[model samples]
Target: MEYRITDGIVEAIIESHGAELKSFKLLKNNEEFMWKADPKFWGRTSPVLFPIVGGLKDGKYIYHGITYEMGQHGIARDNEFKVISHEKNKIVFLFESNEETLKDYPFGFKLYMGYSIENSCLSIEYRVENISHEEMYFSIGAHPAFSTPTSENIEFSDYYLEFEKNETASRFPLEGKNISRNTIKFLENSKKIELEEDTFKDDALIFKNLNSKKISLKCKKNTRVVTMDYSEFEYIAFWNKVGAEFVCLEPWNGIADFVDASGRLEEKDGIIKLEGQEKYKAILKIEIQS
Candidate 1:
């Protein structure tokens, strides 16, 4: 089912499947800030990446000496969630491990996702609880696609990403579906990155240890903006389909497997290890400007 929330300034739609955000719009002009999920370019608007952020080596991983096959971004986005709570401006959805999930992921877990709207900003919160006797290993991230060039006259190249602070970071390049060991300098000392069609010719740009927790998508031809604040995440990724009209701003607590990975789930880069009865939480905030 779909739930609607509004704070008089902005309106949003939260869906039960994957507990995903389906739409975000400005009330003043009824202009949509979220992507329309154009299948010609990309079919998903916003998906929750859990258990794994990216792809594993050969779409398989080893856990306790046993091999398990799982697809990219895990099973969360494809599974249905139960509504835990609901209000006019807030909603929460819950997902728990089942026999189906245990086939690929042996550990039992409870995942809670909440969406709340306040004024012009939307806050998304994720909570994971380990419910098994053994230690649980996993990763979680957000994939939110926002429309570029809020104005019709502005071209894709006219938009740019402005970081809250100057960054001297490295971009972890991807080889096929796995992450490569080599990295190249990304931002240098600049605070802004101009967008272009060829910018993602390689793949998504993954960054670690960035100086800023907030970034804004802006256009030179218009005053509208989309800002994302991810203070709790350890890594951030930027991606888009070539020639697509939208960009995904991802904030992750874990990442994909390395090309030379040991096949062990716990050994994957950025994997979170949680003991029995332990819980972890993270938040991502997005604000739309008109």
Candidate 2:
């Protein structure tokens, strides 16, 4: 099922499958700011990553002496979510652990994804609760893809991502989808990165420590801009398919396994641990201007 909400200035469409945001558009000009999910490039607009983010070392992990098999980004994106609440400009979806999930995750939990629109900004919030008797370990992240250029006259290369503050962060390149130990200087005292076709040749640019929590996408010839604020997130990622017309700004509270992982979920890098009856929350705000 799909739900829609509009706040005079912006309208959004969210589906129940992943409780994912399928579309975000400006009401004044009827211009879409979200990706169209082109299968030729990418087929998702915004997907919720839970229990895990990115790929495991070998598509497997160990928990409490038992080996579990899980694919990249976990199963949240493919699972169904229940609509818990809906308002004129806000909606909330809930996903609870079941028998099938226990086979791979072995934990009882509830994930709530909420979307709200106010004026020109859209807010995406996630709340995870541990329902199991024992402590639960997991990861959660956001993958929201926005259309590049925003205007047909502007080329993708003319666009760039501007950070709120100057940063000198290192990029951890991926090794066949798995996290690698090698690090390279990505942003050296620069606040913006010009978009290029080869930017994602080696997969997503994962940054562990960044000085900025907000980033804006801008084009040289276009006045349209999109800003993403993820103050509560611990890590950030940028990615796009080669020659694709969209880019993803990801805010992650947890990351994937290392190339040389210990195979234990508890020991995985950037994993979140929650005791019984505990909850965790994160927020991502996206603002569009033209």
Candidate 3:
């Protein structure tokens, strides 16, 4: 089912299945942006990461001396979440590992996601519990794609990212996909790039070793803006298609390697493990201004 929660400053639409956040509308000083969720293209505020974020070496991972097959971005993002509790400004959604998930994850676990709106910020909290007798492992993240320039009529090329600091980002070169091993050019100044669908002609620009926590998307004219402070997350991703008005500012706890990885889960970045009956949590918050 779909549910709505609000605290006057912000409003959120959450789906119980998969604990997905369908919409996050920032009510700015008495006006709403009217965020919408398309039933056909509905995606979690950001897709959830679990047993794996991307494909393991050949779609298999080495665990306990055995190999298991997994797909891209795990399965939790599309699953249905159960509404466990709610109040005026907070809502909690839960998902328990089941027989179906076992086919892909092969682990016993419980995932609880909470969405809270207070004033102008939205706080996302994630809790994962190991339900098996032995230890279990996983990864978590947020993928909220916010509308850039805070206006619909503007072209994607009109948007520019403003970093809190003058720090430059480092790009990780992708291999094993017929793509060459070369680092992508990082944006230093406020530059503009035209958006073209089917472009991205190359692979995704992977970034590692970042130290900044805040980034903003604004018009080249600097009239409209939306910002995100992800100081808590280990990394951030900036991506959009050619002509995509929306920009996806992703905050991740981990990332997947090229398809031809060495089939070692431990070697993967940001992989976490929990002892029997233990739990882990990660939180991300977003503040928007118009």
Best by lDDT: 1
lDDT of 3 by residue, 1-290 (tens): 87888888777777776676667765665433322433343333456666565545566777667777777667887788888899988988888999898776778999989989887677888888998888777877676666543356555556666667665555655464212235576655433333444334354555555655677766665555566777767766655543444666777777765544566666666678789999888778777656
- The CA lDDT of each predicted structure is 0.91, 0.91, 0.66
**How big is the positional error of residue 271 in model 3, measured in Å on the Cα after superposition?**
1.2
Candidate 2 segments exceeding 4 Å error: 150-152
Runs of candidate 3 with Cα error greater than 4 angstroms are 28-45, 149-153, 173-182, 185-203
Cα lDDT of candidate 1 equals 0.91
TM-score-better candidate, 2 vs 3: 2
Determine which window of 10 residues in candidate 1 has minimal summed lDDT: 147-156
> Between the candidate structures 1 and 3, which one is better when assessed by lDDT?
1
* Candidate 2, run of 10 with poorest lDDT: 148-157
The residue-by-residue lDDT of candidate 2 on 1-290, one tens digit each, is: 99999898899999999989998988899989888899998999899999899999889999989999999899999999999999999999999999999999999999999999986789998999999779999999999999984355667889899999999989888888688888888888999999988988888999976889899988888788999998999899999988888999999988878788998999999999999999998889999988
- Cα error, residue 197 of model 1, in Å, equals 1.1
Q: In model 3, what is the error at residue 109, expressed in angstroms?
A: 1.3
lDDT of 1 by residue, 1-290 (tens): 88898898999998898888989999999989888889999999899999999999999999889999999999999999999998888888999999999999999999999999997789999999999878999999999998884346778899899999999888999999889989988888988988998899998999997999999988888878999999999998999898888889999998988899988888899999999999999989999987
